[model samples]
Target: MTPRQRRVAIVLGIVAALAAATALVIDALRSNMVFYYSPSQVAAQQAPGGRAFRVGGLVAPGSVRRDGLQVRFVVTDTVQMLPVRYEGLLPDLFREGKGVVAQGRLAADGVFVAQEVLAKHDENYMPPEAADALQRAGKEQP
Candidate 1:
């Protein structure tokens, strides 16, 4: 092969290798990725089942229950509610009638099994997912 043709082949091979590496990385990350959803979406069965995801909404009033290291609460978007089960100590900001986002997977029975729970940092600072959910729910309200 001419030197020019050999150089072209080397470059093409390098490009193909890079593309393969990128694809592999994306495939690996896809499994680890967690999507965010709202209680309304979850209630409507729009959220993906059996995958790790985030659900954000207001903590429903009178829904917080604790049993030693385990806690259960209901996240609501005013139109729908999703039950969440979490283990371990909750953040100080976690409370009823507040915004919260739980990262986990949905159980077969429909409850969210949270691996992590994050409460709003301040009264005026609801998570973006929670705010968007509330807005969407409000617009859908009759």
Candidate 2:
């Protein structure tokens, strides 16, 4: 083949490889994507029906109950509430009326079975996803 033809062929091969790589990356991301939703959004049936996702809001006051290592709490956006069950030790910053984000899937009983529970690290820093959710619910952290 002529030098010009060889150069064009090499360019086309590189483009094809890049396109394949991009498609693989996008597919990986799509499968791993976990969306965040507020209590109100979950209540309105906007959360993922069967897949794992994240729910964020304030831990409702007087709604935390513990049974041995298992803890049950209600996450509220001031307008709606979502019941969450976590069977593990909670973070030190986790408390009633504090911003929290729970990553898990919803059970058939309408309770969130949290695989992981995350609490704000400090008094002023709420998770960005939780903060945005709270803001949409007409509330903000102190």
Which candidate leads the pack in lDDT?
A: 2
Query: What tens digits encode model 2's per-residue C-alpha lDDT throughout 37-123?
Result: 998889889898889999988999999999999999999888899999999999999999999999999999999999999999987
Q: Candidate 2: where is the Cα deviation over 4 Å? A: 1-22
Q: Candidate 1 clashing pairs? A: none
Best by TM-score: 1
Cα lDDT computed for each candidate against the true fold: 0.90, 0.92
lDDT of 1: 0.90
lDDT by residue (tens digit), candidate 1, 15-129: 9999999999999999998899998899878889878899998889999999999999999999899999999999999989888999999999999999999998876798877
> What TM-score does prediction 1 earn?
0.87
